[model samples]
Target: MDAYSGYNQIFMHPEDQAHTSFITDRGLYCYKVMPFGLKNAGATYQRLVNHLFAPLIGNTMEVYVDDMLVKSRTADQHIPNLSAMFTILKQYKMRLNPTKCAFGVASGKFLGFMISQRGIEANPEKIQAILDMTIPKTVKDIQSLTGRVAALTRFISKATDRCAPFFKALKGTKRNITWTAECETAFSELKEYMGRAPLLSTPEHGDILVVYLSVSASAVSSVLIRSKDNAEHPVHYVSKALQDAEVRYPDIEKLAFSLVVSARRLRPYFQAHTIHVLTNQPLRQVLQKPETSGRLVKWAIELGEFDIHYKPRPVMRGQAVADFLSEFTESQASAATQHITEPNPPLSQDQTPTKNTLDLTQPLWTLFVDGSSNAQGCGAGLVLVSPDKVALEYALRFNFQASNNEAEYEALLAGLRLAKEMDARQIQIFRDSQLVVHQVNQDFTAKDASMTAYLQHTRHLLATFHAHTIKQVPRSENSHADALARLASALEQGMGRHIHIEFLAQPSTQAPLICTIDHSPTWMDPILQFLQNQTLPANPAEARRVRHRSARYLIINGSLYKRGFSLPYLRCLTPEEGHYVLREIHEGICDPASKRLAPRQPRLLPCRRKTHFRGARHLLKLSAAKPNLQDTCRHHNGLHKVPHWNFVQSSHFHFPINKEQYLGKTKNHSPTFTVTLPELLLVTDLGIGERSAGTTPVSEA
Candidate 1:
């Protein structure tokens, strides 16, 4: 059943109708019935339908405002359901359009999806949109394809992974597309998939649903399935591309990430049913492990409200789940168990536990922090001991200069951060520095501006803990942390000679703010004005220079940079320097990768060979004489200072310089060639009449 002119059927209040009065050509009048464009018309009409059909709703009929469904379990009940719906419409003085109304039908279209006893099917027209599409040539075409795919993502399994190639193509330069072989394969696969897209099953009430997860390097995918009569059907398919740092996550972490993505996307389904996460990995153990860090810990806490269970994925039950079954280095076998449950939810930030209301007498974490700033360098070290005695040792070496007291503050801050990641409810910190401990405990005032900023940040993090304390310990008492700090300080000076050391670019209390400068009337402005608009500065010399300069540099997204195949976009160099750069790349003397290859070569070593290691090393450049330079290097590290070397490596046609040229050896018998910058340039300009003249072998005098 359908209500004809549904919004018009709802009458406006007699008194309030005056506000809606509008001037027409004939006369000024107000709407007695609710108008279609009025903001409240649809809601008012829906309210009327809901009130009139309250008894029939969800029983023999389903009403969504104007469009009404009079459903029945049997043929006999259909007539009664229609009669009940018609009576309400008549009493409410609402008319039904005969053309739009359909009665006693088993199936029909409600939303965009088709509805029937069999299941919900994708709209045929939507699927046809994809099938009819030719190969995408531009960004817009790929975008259109993705849009069409998104509308029916529930039916298309691993949708993100399937269309990842299209996304990659789209991410390239917008003006000119480089559609590779990968795109063709993916596009064909997409059309084929959509042609035979699966019918998404609607889950029945009280039926337990299963979710199978799949994690690839590029994307995380999951399929929600409902079991009926021993047959599993897919309810929804979820797939998301892993962006930025997510791509670098460990295999198990990626699995957890997939579950988190699925949970957030399918929150409504998760809230409605007991979802069993089917996975062969120890996902439950990883997420629930006591040693789990803050990232996974937060994920587990988010899923706390739902009755989500983890179980070993069973044999592929349906064709929909075939994609979920992975064959890889990761072991799929789990101990034979139907359900491996998680422990009860931990106390999240949302759960506010007061000391009085809730007994906050649990043992707090112990932190030992120390900082060193002697002649060696500046560094901080900390050891975080959980209530259970698991100790986490951390050291930070600072790149920027910091004082002894500042280093002490850094040590304290690092300890707090590590402790927070461990989800420590309470903590007791011991620091060797009296000034740091005193400042944190408010026993000493922070006079310096930097120290004050650090103090505020420290207080903010400390507030996150239920209860935390800090006390000053003697240098001897905090020996372990002190030693760790000394080690970090020594490592900063490159004296440790062991282990992977991380340098802290900035202090712990401060996060670097990246602000992009939109400089007006930049160096590129006059150049761009000349090129695009043919407008330039009034002066003839300046205008001519602008026109000349525009040729060497191209303005891309409002930044002036020197562009060349041989050089990096040089933004750091001045215009004069950039001019010299262009000359070098075009004129046989540009070592693009070497920053020291400036016009003057400020920090470069002298061309004269150092006699300290006689004939041990040689820098080779392509000579005008050698068409096929079959040079070899076993120890390339010892070689340096030759121009046009980057060009030789990049261009395949540039003199056939063998791998040995770059990776040459001091220990090998392979002949080496040493040529000065001026000599190399002369060699490039003129072909070698003889080897003795243009090219000089290192083995010879």
Candidate 2:
């Protein structure tokens, strides 16, 4: 049942009526009833229906803005349900459009979709509109085509991949589009698919749902499926086009990303039912223990709210599901070098190989690696040759110093990473470094700590593949990789050259030291929990307060940031971290003066001064404690005065601050150390790191 003039049903308040005043031909007029096209008109009507049908919505009826759906399990309950709905409408003085309303119907259109007992389906008009569209020749036509596809994305599996050619055509020139033959082929397939679009299934209560994930070069897709009577039906289809850095994510990370995207888009389904992610990749382990990358940590936190489980996808059951799963499985298999699928017989005299089990007869990829380290610089290079004889060459320059053996390990590790990204199952490695190859092959022991770390890391990556072999080859035979390594290592500090060189900031063996505030309860704990998982305190008042405060805050990549009036967003920090930042700013700003005063000590103590915190970026002016009256400090005991020093956040250094009182309180009379206010008082709940260059920490002294 559809409400007649839904917005007009609600009368505007006497005071609000004046705000809707408009000039007419005769005189000014104001609307007594709520008017359409108002920014909050739709939302206002939705709230009214929600309040009116609070007991029936989601149980016996469903409503969105003006559209109302009255549902019953059988014909016997239909009249009673309609009676209950009509009683509420009578009490609220709401009228229904007789022409638009349909009663006692098995299936009908609701919210631009065909809804019935069978399942929700795309409207026939929408499918006809796509079928009626002609071949797009201009940019606008292609845009219209993409816009139509966007409306039916939930019904289309891997929608982004299918429409990638159309998106590519829209790029570059706006007036004229580059309509390639790929577009024509994709357009025809799309119409063919639309003609027989699968009917989506509505999951019943307590029914477990399954999600099949697919990752392509530029997009990630997943289909949510519901199984009943040994047959699978698609609940929804989701696909996202990767942008910028997302396009370069490792294949495993991309698989995890597909789940995250599904969880976000299908949040309602995830919240209501249990989700089992069907995949062969180690997505569960990667997300469960996300210490390797920051993005993984964030994705894991966001997905923690839902009950998601990982399982190896079983054999396809239904044709609708087979259509989606077949494509997903085929894409992954075809990406591997010489990958083939063969069914194994049941166990008897000869047992058949299980799924995903490696066949030794398959061709293995070849990897050639070399490293160069000299007075100029250190660098590594590798060439990965596929079974099909396609070769991929990569050069990596180390930002930090590395020994020749370490560089060789880096080269081997880089090659393994490339192979993994290409979905290679078996690999054979040949390296010019005899020590590295022998150590990896277990012929020699890695006695050095750094070498042991590198060896362990290499073994960890090697474990991902089905099988791998490492051997030492003469430098003469590995000339390609050796020359690439030299080319990258010998390049000048500042030169214009582009060969897709990658800079390794640090070795993979070393884990970065990051200060995480999520472990303990802080000012951001309540807000972070609410924003991430919708978790709130048991107390009603506390929950309300958290909800109100969360409006000004949002979590981005696992960090809490507060929206500010002056600034767009500011990262929140703990008081302990704030004190560390202030001290670092003092050291960086007054490094030269502190070294001049106490050349032997080089300690720039934080003096008494007012501090201000605001905006995403801030400049801090710190006063360095100087005993002498000169512009620069020369002594540590006579008389002290504040000096002007300014600095921005650039680097981080570790130093300890004396917490003793600084105002006229002296124990040993060694220039009374002032502790001033507490750590929390120095910076509010919102704070950031500050630093400057060239400073010797007092801890070192």
Candidate 3:
């Protein structure tokens, strides 16, 4: 129900009414009651409603500013829920607009969404808006279309992918777009999808939600699903178009990115319920492994807040879920249990069968690998052929430099990793590098340190499979892998191809950087715990105080931010970080005038209390003062007597350092200055280390 004249319901103080006054044609007018368009007007109304409906806000009612919703699980509870809400309104003398309020309805529009007994659904008006749109002819028209699509993105699966064409058209300066067939096809497909927008399911307490991730060449998408009664219903669909460096991420990293994006967008659902991510990818292992890529480690930490479980995805049980399942094809090697095919060509009858020869009795997947290193770049390519002849082609470009032998090992390792990911139990590996193959087969010794490391890593991976064979093949026989390696090494990005190309930022043999996270207690700790977990002090009074104070603070992305009346939300920092900021500001670069005035005006250093300049790395920027410090500097005994430090050190001011004893006043008493003006004031004497003094004026002294 909507409040009748919501802003006017709250009265303003008589003394403060003049501040809101406006002059009219005849006389000055002032608002006695809170008026619309005033800052914090909505907040005031919300606070009043919250006070009245504190007990029912989350249970039977929901409120956003003046808009209120009284929800009931069953028809029998509907009247009671409405009565509870009305009783509070009556007691507070709050009136509702009959024209804007509805009661005893099964479903109604709330906040631009159609809420019903079935579930929350896209607004009919929004769907109609997209359905009614004509082909976009201009840039503005395309933007309008994309904006509408974004509004109902949750209802559309792979929304970013579907709208990628329009985004591409918007690039560069163009008043009119070509409106190619691709855009028209995407436009029609979008309208068709919107015509039958899926009904989103709202998960209840204790209901486990499942997330399915989909990664593509240009975009990553995931759908949050709720399983009930042996069927799956979509809770939300999330998708993002990769940009800049993101486009170069490996397929596995893209999968992780999809999950991260989903978690960020659907944090409320994640916090409320346990999420089970369904995928065939080794996401859990990658995330749980201590030694992994830096970004994966960061994504894992971000998702650590939720109770998430990783499980192999099962067969598609519902149409909506099946749609997401069909969004991407999983690259898998043929099963190892297949019947043995024709045996490989036997060597001369007199020659003994070597360990590298494939056994005819057992089914083995064939792997052909090659590497290329040139002036252009370094890359590796591998083809994993299943027993049934299904080939999985993969190419990898190394972001870092590598030699020819190193790239060959990279190719072999890449093939092994692909086989592992495909669950291939037994495999036969063929490479064009005779040295690498002979080393792996123990026919050649790896004398070089890098070669030894690569051989050890290759054997470690080979141990995971049930059985494996390695042999060297001539370059002519391994042409497929050779061509792929060359393609990956020289081809510029954005050139579309069927072969999946991924960029590896570092060599496989290099160990991942180990980083330690500091979790020491900070001022935000208590507030964050209270806000996130509802934990409070044991003392009753302190608990109450914490609850009240938590209203002005909020936690976002594991960081605490404070709310304000007029200022933007500010991030709260620990004391150590705050000190660093203050020190930087105190010693940052300053104008020449500040430097010249600094030594002359020592009084500026002490305002109400003494300011210590200990461990200063930069020259102090002193504000100009009327009093000259030249008198404070005097020559005595062929040395410049600097009295400023003595005066500061002797002053009985409450500061960080101790004060010197004060002598009784004498008419002729002059300050004793034994140290020279600059020469005697060494950096070590002031406790500023030699390293810090190098950047300060004390270094000259």
Candidate 4:
């Protein structure tokens, strides 16, 4: 039952009520009862519930903050359970909303889910919200869809993997989304799945709960199960989209990640019962190793509290586990190659590569391309197999948001580019995206301007090969590439399973210049000379001095920089630049229009220092366009509020802070975050429009 004005039900301490008063035309007034804005209102209400329901909790009743439920084994006992709860409510002067509360109900919705003797199930309304919805066109629409999906993720299998395509749509700065074929297929499938969504079972005391872990290219999934009468039923499904460095984790790590996530989400289950992790991987050995990677040790420690045991998976016992097995099965040819549905028998022994060998001849290269863009993020996965049957897996993560179609084209483009780099003359491309294949073959007209551009670029790239053929196959046939795409699009979120995966900062549509007009030295030459050549000035004394100063020196974006004792990477400026900076620091007094400095008396030290310390950027703030800061601030706020983070934009920087901490910082650091601060800390702008020379990272001495 729902509480009546739950937070406001209790009276505040007489003296404290005055603190909550608001100003008005009338004399000051305060809340006699606890108000909604009280810092400890929720916690205080929870304490009251715990106190009142102490005996009934976990036996006949379950109370979560203001929401309470009474359960009984028999119909006759139901009345007594209700009476006992009501008796306590009366003693505490507690009230329930008559319209919100129900009596003698067989089943009902609570805490955004439906609970009953049949076990827990996702709310029908939540499922219908996605099903009844039209295709999402705006960023907000896609965001809304993702939000609904997140609420029901526990009921959905491989939830992160399945919804990957939507995340791709929200990537990058493109405001208008490209709703592609993959999204349409996924949308239909999601609705169909929701139409008959599985009923989640609850584990009974002493039940030996088993967890089946499944790790895909871009997601880690686990299903918590309990057996009854020799039949297995799912208690909960957990999924997480891996990002950044997490994507590079080994297979065992991914498995561990899945288990860790499951344990975290179902902490109560772990605390109460023993959990058997069913997997072929050596999870325990890795976690229990004397020495291991930092994250593994961290994950191991995180999972240390759980009563978890690892064991090899037995044969699939139920349809649900069977489904998990099917989605995550890898091919023999490439351990990294994941097929959504199991493929037919191997083509031949020649088609499989042996260790320590690759023959790049035969003039034929096979390409499988699949693109997934979902709420976790958008990415394209491609498996390029050379003539010798050696698979070269490339997962291209778009630096920006892309639609499914755009992602498909990206995968195809990336695959062709890789093959071209390998100097492959002939190619046979296989993709699950029918629209992209048909468009490339001129069978389907490129109706949209974006697709037309993509199709044109694809054709242009395909033309580089001596012979190339494109075919649209069933999704199952292209599962390997599809998995690769999902992995690529949602990279840095999880560890990579098989072969090494590479990320592309941008799409082929916005191709960068492959060749530059000239390659020459600039400000970086001195540092590069000192580091690489170990050469200093001709004079021995000056040379020794130059070598000494090079320790903290770094060349960033064609300019020299020094690692400041306190600051990070301070720009090393030339005399001319320093003069211009000093002038800009005196922006108000020094007129840029006049060639000579004004013959005016200088101000006192403190006043002059104040203006000087404000820096040139702050002084000239009115002249510079800082739409980036406003857009960035808005994006930052939107990111915190998003239920599911869309990794559509490939290179959104992730700081050490988590989402919760970020929100806290946002609130405390800047209540009015809309106003852009001065760009005092500028990224390198050497006046050179583009990079024209080879680059290397700065090494701190």
TM-score of candidate 1 relative to the true fold? 0.46
The residue-by-residue lDDT of candidate 2 on 203-269, one tens digit each, is 9889999998887878889899999888889999999999999977876777788898999999999
Model 3 lDDT tens row, 504-613: 99989899999987857765676777766757778856655555465556655467766544536667776556544433333333221233333332222222223323
lDDT of each: 0.70, 0.75, 0.75, 0.70
- Model 2 spans with C-alpha error above 4 angstroms: 326-701
Off by over 4 Å in 3: 13-30, 326-701
Q: Clashes in candidate 4: how many?
A: 37
lDDT, residue 18, model 2: 93
Kindly report which residue pairs in candidate 2 clash with one another.
597-633, 649-691, 662-674, 662-675
Model 4 weakest lDDT span, ten residues long: 598-607
TM-score of candidate 4 relative to the true fold: 0.48
**Candidate 1 segments whose C-alpha is farther than 4 A from its true place:** 14-30, 37-47, 173-175, 242-254, 285-302, 327-701
Among all candidates shown, the one with the greatest TM-score: 2
Global Cα RMSD, each model = 26.4, 15.8, 18.5, 27.6
Q: Model 2 misses residue 613 by how many Å? A: 28
Worst 10 residues of 1 by lDDT: 627-636
Q: Look at candidate 2 and tell me the lDDT of residue 466.
A: 66
lDDT of 4 by residue, 480-532 (tens): 88877777666664675675666667777675778755634444455568644
